[model samples]
Target chain A: MSPRRGTRRLRLSDPHRRVRFGLAVVLTVLTIIGGRLVQLQGLDGMKYAAAAEELRLTRLDLPAARGQILDRDGNALAYSVEARAIFADPGMIVAPGRTALALAPLLATSADALMGELTADGRFVYLARGLDPAGAQAIMDLQLAGIGELVEQRREYPAEWTAAQVVGFVGQDDTGLAGIEDQYDDVLTGTPGQLVYEQGRFGLPIPAATHSLEEAVPGSDVQLTLDQDLQFTLEQALAVANENAGVSSAQAVVLDVATGQVLAMGGSPGYNAADPGGVRGDQLANPTVSHVIEPGSVNKMITFAGALEEGLITPETELTVPDNIAVSDIVINDAWGHAPIHFTATGILGKSSNVGTVMLAQQLGNARLEEYLRRFGLGTATGIELPAESNGILLPHEEWSGSQAGTIPFGQGVSMTVLQMASMFQAVANDGVLVPPRIVDQVIGPDGTVIDQPGSEPRRVLEPDTSADLRYMLESVTNEGGTAPLARIDGYRVAGKTGTAQRPNPECRCYAGGGYWATFAGFAPADDPRYVIAISVEQPGGSGGGGVIAAPVFTSIMSFALGDNGVAPTGTPSPEFRLTTDED
Target chain B: MSALPAYDRPQRVAGRRTEPTRVSLQRPVAAPAPAGRAPFVALILFVIGAGLIALLVLNTAIAADSFTERSLSQQIEQLRLQEQELQQEIGAAQAPAALARAAVEQGMVPAGPPGFLIVHPDGTTQVVGEAKPATRPPPPARRN
Candidate 1:
């Protein structure tokens, strides 16, 4: 080889030139890449990321569980449970008719309705709102495309119609529409939440991906003071009472005298809380608090209370009472005809003498009677934890006409709720102290914290001696000679009053062709006076009175109340009552 | 043994016999070698390969766990539904109306007035109320 020639010949491909070329190419590529990075990371980043998330992310709205309504004994009166609802994505459905046919039987709905829903021009349609777990599983096993089930809730009323009026019902959207459910809607309903996560290709959440949960807070439970079993008994008895063709509706309530807790309250024509849609809208309300009636002889107690409080007469004071009396332009008469008789104040109340009561009222005057009426928690809502309570009609003392003065004393012109009538006797039964009745005993939080309701403040309505005297007087009504012998419980002594008042006709706006409200208010073991019960029946086309219609029911309930609570009679012998100074 | 016969046969075929190659040693003889970098290179390759396999296994485990978690969640949802159904059944069976209806079906009648037995402090028992002999009631009203 020629080494001199090789050295002299120019090296055409020099290392320096190759190095420069490589550097230039690398610099140009790096510049391009850097420019692309800036464009991607700075300017269009937000819009791109949002688009990607929109494709890969899914958000779900989680509804919190509604609280339960429990009775005093920790029994569930109403509860909400998660159920499944059948929905269809019409756009994804291949054959609407076939899918509907397969789903109709499981969903318990018409095939035609489902077909219409499945073919509707929307992305989603509900074929059934609630399906049990087994039924939902059956539908899912069919694996029909476009048909899917989602979690929903169904409110179950296990007690059925027992305390339906007091416990109330919920609407389709889980909103409380009536009763305690409606009154404590905020307490029973909870806050909603959201769950957001990145979705994988198979509709499952990606592992360790971005996930967030805004948790839902469940509602607190509200426990009522009602006794479930006693409520059932009252409901059963009231239902039987309403079976008469003449009777339109009936109502009843029982209370604990000391605590003023409503142990049981019910009415006829009650709706099932689980299925409120089957009944008339007007019938869904609790008539005991919402409806009013001329309280009749049930109102005489207040008049007598006022007289005794004002030192007008003692139980043994004798008075000459006639069959009828003319006060202002109206002539009021007793239910039975009688000549002038000398009788004690106890006999006047025990016999439910309208004329005698008015005579005492005349002595007491209107202001004092109205004042007594107000003190009995009348002419106003009872401030109970119920919705749509009525403040019954009681004319202010200044607004009383002449005839009103006569009849108002005997509860003819005056109208009050059944609850008010019951409360009147409660004051006497509780030794002259008045405690406003309450239905809710306490509230239980979701996390197991207990919130007790403040005890109701009781006020004095009558002196203790006057209350004792009243109890002695009222007990005569359930005896042999007085009215309402059927109200006599077997073992315990019962004290009660009976009222039969004519109702005003709605069409005529008068008393011509109206009905009569037969009412009974009483308490058992009259000496101790533990439980107070009141019942009423409205007979629109009948001639029966409270003794005939209302007293028997009271007997059934009062006997049970005494026996169920295991209350013992005082065993004190009954003292002889001087009903008449001239003994018959 | 068959291969030796073939080799003899080729040799006997004389005209196509292969020539024996001559072997010679080089002038610059190789040094007695110490251990070379080949083993180290092999070790590095093995470590890189092992690390890559471990990464693959970890990723597979995570993906599998994600799938298991999804199935478990679905199972949990089904169990929740089952619990709800059971609760509903219990509530229905224990409801007062249902009990009354059941009692009627079993030839049981609603009780009348209840009586009490008074126990005196001296260990004497006396019936307080009249315990009326039970009579058959009128057929129960058709209740729901």
Candidate 2:
């Protein structure tokens, strides 16, 4: 047989092998296709879908306004107003030097300064921070290419320095920096809104087809316990005190006796919270709470209150006061040299007798006396919710020396914040209860609902009958021959105390030469106390004390506050007192 | 058990092969009546399965979209609140009352009755609070 014929016959005979080869190829192709289908449908499908959705959608946030600060009468003490500021897109400016030159005159800036700002590498640069409408408009009218006003917000102060320190100010970025602005920042800042839009292929939003949009939630408004008219009156009185006494610093605080609410707080030479550049160094400190000094004769009021509270003395109690008395190896003297003068308990307070005060303190003893001072809210911070309140110095009873013993009775050894004085005086005026001072009247939410309401919560500091008796004795402080005669109001029964404490010499451990702090604390309409005012003047020209400086200021503030609050005059004459020979 | 053959007739084995002794293993004489019941059951099953799958896919898509939208809305609201607060602060910082207060603090008292003069177009000026107006002559011009 031929070789070619034999091979052809062999090939034709293996038909089963050919069919198996064809079936194997078909199976391989099907496996590859199935694997790819699984990868697309099961393994990576969600990841791809999310990427596609992200490429088509974009969201942006919008911000809300800060809260408003208003007075009790709903007058805007501090509120927001819109203003324009010119900002430059540095990338867009064609000629930085030329643009700076054109803007310098319009912005009231030097050309060099403008050039420095223009040459900054930032995309957005502030050419001017606070520009008026006319100035902004003028700059815009110049048609300077690349320089334009950015629609950014600026804070506006409607009342400026009227309630400067209380309202506080915001920084250039509109963040609160001090005062109440710093304090309720969270409540004052509102919720931002969202704008969702469809995005194009290159990740830019499609102009017209923005989908879902949400509005911003605005901030709540804050209402204060202060009255604008009463605040103005208090400021005027402080100004008068500063002028008359030539004092470097002075402060006055007025509060409602029944409710611990602060009505007016004023300091001389205050700054505009909106424009902080005009602040002075010495005047920056709030003297009413930040500075501490010896209280002098004002301490006698505390001593008298303690004695009366303990039933140690009454209006008819007779005490024979000499010019000087030696106790605990320390000599105490009256303000005027005189013979053994017979004086009632009422007379002793009226004359502000140093010997009389010591006799009372000695009768009460150390433990009882210290307890009363503590109860009266002395030598400690009043916790009035304002920052930087000084805790005045009070030596522990274990550390009290013989000299401090006699001196403390007439307000020499201890010191207290003006708020503490006002609070303690409120106890006498309020018939026995001492309420914590409140500066915030109410917190209103964005929807005009009151979120937090403040009211007086009184704690009994003295017995009711004792408070009345003390009020009767305090009446003498505003009458003729009293140390605080200037504190009298024509138609009201005012109760007050005067102080002239010598500046303590830390080096010598004794009072220094000619430096004194004058102070007066009082309340009006003794029958039904309405207002309590305390004023302090540092280093007046004369031997400054409550009588010569602080008393007059207190009188003015009290009179104005009473009138503003619609408190009618009592028209009752000052209680008269006569020395009695009989001892109680 | 080889065939006993047709020799043993049906009358002898009546109990065992009652109807037909050997049924032919060939095509049936005629096709039995065609049944329509199976097709109806298959149709009902397909419809129910398709509806359930469609419902699951729709629910998943809606849930994903709603979750994304809610988060985006919350973020936008937060930003809007921040912007409003900033705007209010800016306004308060530049209030008219603040400007007036600043002026007063700088010792620039307001011009009022008894001191400053108000000039009118008739070449006449009046003192504050005064009833009569005074006439003034024009000043000599200055050369640049």
Maximum-DockQ candidate: 1
What TM-score is obtained for chain B in each of the predicted models?
Answer: 0.57, 0.40
- Indicate the DockQ of the complex predicted as candidate 2: 0.07
- The TM-score that candidate 1 achieves is 0.88
Q: Candidate 1 DockQ score? A: 0.38
Residue A11's lDDT within candidate 1 is 51
lDDT of 1 by residue, A211-246 (tens): 999998888899999998889888888888889779
The CAPRI classification for model 2 reads as incorrect
Where does candidate 1 chain A have its weakest 10-residue lDDT segment? A4-13
Model 2 error, position A135 (Å): 5.3
Model 1, residue A377: distance off in Å is 0.5
